[model samples]
Target: MSEKVISDYNGYDYKKEFWENVDREYEDQADRMAIRRLLPKRMEKFADIGGGYGRLANEYLKRARKVYIFDYSKTELAQAKEIYGDKIETKAGDIYKLPFKDNELDGLMMIRVTHHLKDMPKAIAELYRVLKPGGVAVIEVANKRTLPKMVRYVTFRSKVNPFSKEVANYKEISADGFYNYHPKYVEEIFNKTGFKRERVLSVSNFRSKTLKKVFKTNNLVKMEEAAQTALAPIRFAPSIYYKLRKPEK
Candidate 1:
């Protein structure tokens, strides 16, 4: 890792406000569970790219012999080191510049991190570069084409165009700003990156406060599990999780 600042990550503190919101935690857990199911049943090594504090990659211990938690935050990596000392390897590296050599990993994950990336194709290619042929990658993307976004657009004439918006190119979340990608755009990214798409899981469908309050947490999780695949083709959820495999070329 070259210690270069990527995606306005120079001075952002994720440890503080990250765990503060209730819905955020629920949504995170939901994303983690959805990503977990897509992982290979067995693997020798895997890297969790941009996985802060090792919360998401920790779940990979059961499936992979060696688990690597890669992040851009040194403080968060230190905290992850403290939490998983000998169990996992923690690397503070930029997502644009992964520390590992080419085709060294049997599996990799990038959950809840793609939104921060300004160049989606480049980042996806980098991830594909590190993965071995026939390896699997579970990537979570914030969906621009979702039910709530479309409903609001039609009902209230909101500024958000969920149906056909490309990259927003703003500076809201980061200096380069974050992006909410349509599933079509994401599939295009995969197509250009030499990755074969397996399927898409529509995650975080019940992430709103009203839905959380109306249903128990367990029930919401159950509902999410049941509805994810059925809703994915239509892109009905706020988050879309893609399971992709590198072709054996």
Candidate 2:
């Protein structure tokens, strides 16, 4: 078989370069709020797939008996190990070929990682295989059908179709394989992989630079919390979070 495309962050300091800033505090809090609502109250084995430097590990650490940060970067994993030490386990592996055995995880989450995946179906199947029956998985996607993009399409300002249920790639925006996917397409893949849709939350609804400049981060986060569930049906947000479960036989 041919080798699968992987978005390797081996030498990158994702936590420092991407997250350590005042500008994205609202987005970070918005994500955490959604995750808190979706994640199981308690679990035996929980993992954060593509959890670089364990940025969100503390969210699940108290809830799960065993928490792991699994990623494709040794550098990130090493950082995770340094920060978390024995509190959380770190593993380096591909999303399509996870190291965990079948039915080993009580719950798992893959946030901000879907866009990097070239074979989403294969990666999702691996998640289904590892999660126990009735286990929950929280997956996040960069949405192609955002309101701004739709407006651009309708106004003849952009060539891409926002209504189409296909993956949208703009290499010019980010050459590192950044993709935006339609929500329906992602849901269909999850359903095909035997996952039942539990809930959907529209995160980062107010991710405008102008809005951030005008309002405080906490106020924006409060607005985001209120809008996540209400705006989910329309799915006009740039980031969409899905709560899925594997049914018990």
Candidate 3:
């Protein structure tokens, strides 16, 4: 939240072209769907931290009075500017030291950014500071402990793992940069940052290319109904969605 904390985390140049490609490629279909679920009916001003390419920000603009899209990468901002025009504001800024005043934003959505953050607590505190009382924050993070993710780690040795030598050497960097998170870790971080946890949802409880193909058959609504009923009670869904709020009074 202070200048030093902000400065320390500012070294990652996400605005570069190469990183933008990484981010766009690593973008998750499930996260896009989850953000749609948590979106507010109407927001005065919404800020999206680490919103690469502004996909979610573009969607929020339709319902928000004003939208601000912040990312450390200028390359991503270029695409966002093309897609949004003047409807959305793009700023190359660090998430830890948001360039906004206290209680200045109505809502915040941080999609797939927790792992890239150098200090989760400081970043969340900044988000809490900028958000007005009753403002909501929705965060999307990969489940480090999920069965699918663990299998992927061992079998793929891909960008999803922060400890892999392949990823550590930057052979392949995930679109969002360094990401390492556990499913329940978010609750602890949010509570430490003064946000009260509200709702939690899971996505892609059972995800696989072959399984997805099966669900894509006859009726989309029926598939959704069946999946929700079957997976809603399960604790370890593939991806986790957290809805939190800044305390009022």
Q: Compute each candidate's TM-score over C-alphas.
A: 0.90, 0.96, 0.73
lDDT of 2 at 106: 96
Tens digit of lDDT per residue, candidate 3, span 82-136? 8789988887888867888999998989876665664666777899999999999
Estimate, for each residue in 1-249, the C-alpha lDDT of model 1 and write its tens digit.
Answer: 222336544354565567653346667678777876798889999988987877775578888999998988887778778888888898877788799999999999998787777778878989999999999999998887777778988898667788785864436556656678888888998998899999788898887888877888888888887788778778878788899999998
Model 3 collision count: 5
Top candidate when judged by TM-score against the true structure? 2
Candidate 2 lowest-lDDT run of ten: 1-10
lDDT, candidate 2, at 196: 98
lDDT of 2 by residue, 4-81 (tens): 667778998788888984468898899899899999999999999999998888789999999989999999999999
lDDT of each: 0.81, 0.91, 0.66
Error of 1 at 166 (Å): 1.2
| Model 1 steric clash pairs | none
Candidate 1: deviation at residue 235, Å? 1.0
Q: lDDT value for candidate 1?
A: 0.81
lDDT (C-alpha) at residue 58 in model 3: 50
